[model samples]
Target: MTAPAAPEVLRHVDALAEVVGRQHVLVGEQVPARHVQDLWGSDRKGVASVVVCPGTPAEVARVLRLCAEHRQPVVVQGGMTGLVSGGVPGPEEVVLSTERLDSIGEIDPAIATVTAGAGVTLADLQDEAARHGLVVPIDLASKGSATIGGCVATNAGGVNVVGYGMTRQHVRSLQVALADGRLLELSTPLVKDNAGFDLKQLFIGSEGTLGVVTAATLALRQAPRTRTGVFCAVADVAGALELLTAIRAQLPGMLTAFEVVWADAYAVLDGLDLRLPLPMGYPVYVLAEVQGGRPEADSEALLACLASIEHVLLDSAVADTAAELAVFWQARERIPSEILRMQPLFGFDVSVSARDLQDCLERMRAELTERWPQVKLLVFGHLGDDNVHIAVVTGEQTRKRKAEVEHIVYGCVSRSSGSISAEHGIGFEKRPYLGYTRSPEEMELMRSLKALLDPAGILNRGRVLTWGNETDPA
Candidate 1:
C-alpha cells in the first residue's frame, strides 16, 4: 500500500488528535522507537506516522471511525512484548496503542471471573486475582510486559497450559471494535452461552487483523493452596513421555507442568554464574509440577508418584519451598537471555504428537547439523502439551542464513504433521511457511473471513495472511 502524502498524513493525524485528545496523540518524532518494531525485530520495520493512545473503548472506536473515513491503515498495538512482530506498524500507518486503556474491572468471586481492559498487564491481573484468592490460568515468562489483549489476540499458551489451557479457554467474553468502527460485544460471563455462533472466537488469535480487542472477561479458578515441583533427569524423549504418563495416571489433575530440556543444550546453564540444583547433567531433564489444596498431603503424593517412576528417571530433585523451586527453574528461564548473548539466533515454537516429538527433533537436528555444523541448538518446552521450543545459535552467521535454517527446521515439522507455530501467531515472519502447516482450503477460508470482516482491510494490513501478496489503499 502506498503511503499517504506528508500533507495527507498530517491531516489524518490532526483528525485523530481531535478524536482522542491531542495530548494522547503523538506524531512523527514524538512516537517512541518501541512503537515501530516489536520485541522480535520485523523485516517490514517502519516508523508509524502517528501513535494514538485511546483511554476508552469509545475513544478507540472514534479513532477507528476517523481513520476509516480517511482511508488510513491502522496497526493496533498492545504491550509491545510480542516476539512475532504482530503489533509492529508500517511507515505510513497510524498506531493505536492500548497502553492508556489500562484498567482492571471488578472480579466476581461468585462466578469465578474477572473483567479487565485490553491494556491491563498480565502481572497486574495475576496480582489482583491473588488478593481475591483466585488465579488467571494463562501465564508466560513475559507476563509483566505482555497485555491481556495481546495474550488473547495470540491465544497465548505457556507452561501452565498443560494443566489449564490457552488464553482462549479462559476468555469468557470479549468486547471488540470492527474495522469499520462498529462494536461487537460477544459471548458473556455466563458459562453456558450457546445462543448461536461464538463470534468472539473469530477475533481471538486473529492477531487484530479482524478487529481491535478492547476488553475481555476471563474465567478464573480458586488459587492452588499447595504447589509441589520436581525436576527429574530422563534418558530421552521416550522416557520423558513415559514419566509424563505415569504422573498423569497417578496424580490425574494434579500435574501442572511437564517441561523437557535436552541435556547438551541445557548444559550451558552450568556455565552461568547462577545456582544449579543438580550436580550432574543427564541426557534429558523434565521438570514436573503438581498443585492441590493440602500442602503436606500433596507434597507426599507427588514424591510417592515420582518414586514410582524411578525406572524412567536417572536423577531427581524435589522442591517444596519457593527458594528451592526458583533454583530449579532458574536454569530454564535464564536460557533466552543467555542465548541472546550469543547473537544471530533463530527461535521456534512448534508442536507434534507426544510420540512424534522425538523423531521430529532428531530429523531437524540432523538436517541443521549437516548444513551448519557450527550451529548450536538448544531445545526445551512444555512437553506434556506436545509443545517444544527450539533455539538455534549461529555463532558466526549471516543475515541470509536465517532463512536457510528456518527452511530446514520447518520442513521437518511439516513432514511430521507438526504445527509450525504452537502458541505464537503467524505474524509476518511465519507468513510464508503458513502454507507448510495449513491446507489450501483452510488458507482460503481464512482469507475469506478476513475479506468479510475487513472488506477495506484497514486493520493490521500485511500481517498474518497478506491478501494476494498485493498492496492496495484501504
Candidate 2:
C-alpha cells in the first residue's frame, strides 16, 4: 500500500492543482501503477509524489513554473509505451503527464501539415491524416498507444525509417515547456527556414530532460495508392543484405521497410503458438514492403526484383491483399512481446554499419555463449537501417547477471564503432553504457547543454546524464 502524501508534499500538490485543477492532480493511491512502471513490464518502477495532468501548453508551463520554484524535480510522461524507463518517475518527484493534451487541429492539406497535442496517440494522428488523404510517415508497432509527444521526444525510428526517415524528419515544430516554466514555441510551417538555429532539434531526442513537449506541428506525406509486402526466407544474413540492396536499387524510394528476422527469433513464433507465415528452418527471414501509386505495376515490379535475386532466397511469400500484409507483419511485430515473456530477459537495441553487422553479432554471440552455454539470443530488426534488437535469456538468474550480458553486448558494439542505442534514447537503463557510443568531449558538450537549458537539474534529474556529478557544469 502507498503511504499518504506528507503535509509538505500535499502543499506542493495543492499548488500544482491550482494550475491544472484539483481533479487532475493525483497523489498516493490515486496514482495508477502504470504511471510509475515501464509499459513493457520491467521490474524497475518509481514513486511520484504527485501526477499532474495538464490540458494545455499554458497549463503545462504553469505547472513547471510551480515545480521549478519549489525545487521539485519533474518527470514528463506521455503514452508510457517506451521500452526504456524514460517516463518512469522518481521518489518525491512530480509527474507531468501530457495525457489531457489530447487535441488535434485542422489538417492543412495545402501545406501537408497538422498540429496536434502531445497526448494524441500516433494511430489517432495517422487516422486523422488519412481522412485528409495524407499520412504521417513515421510508423511504429506501438502506434496505437505511443503518443506524438513521446515519439518526438525520442525521435522514434520505425520500419518506415528506411524510406521516410525518423520522427525528427516528420516534426515541423514543437511547443515545449522549459524547465524554468517558460513556454518556447517554434511552430513554423515553412519547408525551409534558415533564418537562425533550428532550436526545436534540441528537445527532439532529449527524452524530456530539457523540457516537456506539449504539442507538435508535423509534416505529412500524400497517401500512396497501394502498398505491397513480401516475406522471404533468406539463405543467410549476407543473402538478406544482398536482397535488400537489390530491392532498393530496383524499387528506389518505393521500398519503405526491410526488416530482418534471424531464424532463432522466427522460431519463437512457434513457441508462442502463433501461425508461422514462412518455414522456420531458414537462417534469416526478411519482410520487405513497398508503396507506390500504381498497384498492379508496383506489385509486379517488387515481385520481379525478388525473382532477380532467386539464388539468395530459399522461399518467399507475397501479400497480394491488405489482410495478407497484416498477417505477414504480425510475425515480425510479435517477436518483442514473445521474447519479453521469457523470465529474466535482457533486451538490447544497437546499431552497426551493414558491412560489420554480421561479424559483430557473431562475435557477441560467441562471447555470450562461452560465458553461458545455454544462453538463447534472439536477434531481428530494421536491417535496412543497420539496427538490430537482441533478446537474451538463460535458465539461471539472468537478471542478476545483467551487467555481464551488457558488457558482452556493448563491448562488441564499441569494438565495431557502433551505437549502444539505435532508436531508443539513453534512458536511465542505458545511462551507464552511453560512453560506449559517445566520447568524453561529446559527453561534456551534452552536459553543458543540459546545464544551459535546465541549470537546476530538476528536469529528469538522474536520466541520460548523472545528477550533481563533480564535472557537472551546473
- Per-candidate TM vs. native? 0.96, 0.97
**lDDT tens digits, residues 1-474, model 1?**
233325555677667878888998887767777787776554556667778999999999888888887778888998877767788776767889999778998887877899899999999999999988999999888889889899999999998989998999999999999888888799988999999999999999999999999999999999998887988888899999888888889888988888888876677777668887665568888888888898788888888888887888888889979788878778778866666666677888888888898888888888888877787788889998989888887666555677888888888889999998999888777877888899989988998999998887889888888765563221
lDDT tens string, model 2, 396-459?
8748878888889999989999998989888878888888899989988998999998998889
**Candidate 2 displacement at residue 361 in angstroms:** 0.7
Q: What is the C-alpha RMSD of each candidate to the true structure, in Å?
A: 2.8, 2.1
Q: Candidate 2: what lDDT?
A: 0.87
Best by lDDT: 2
Q: Report the C-alpha displacement of residue 8, candidate 2, in angstroms.
A: 4.9
In candidate 1, which residue pairs clash? none
The true-structure Cα RMSD of candidate 2 reads 2.1
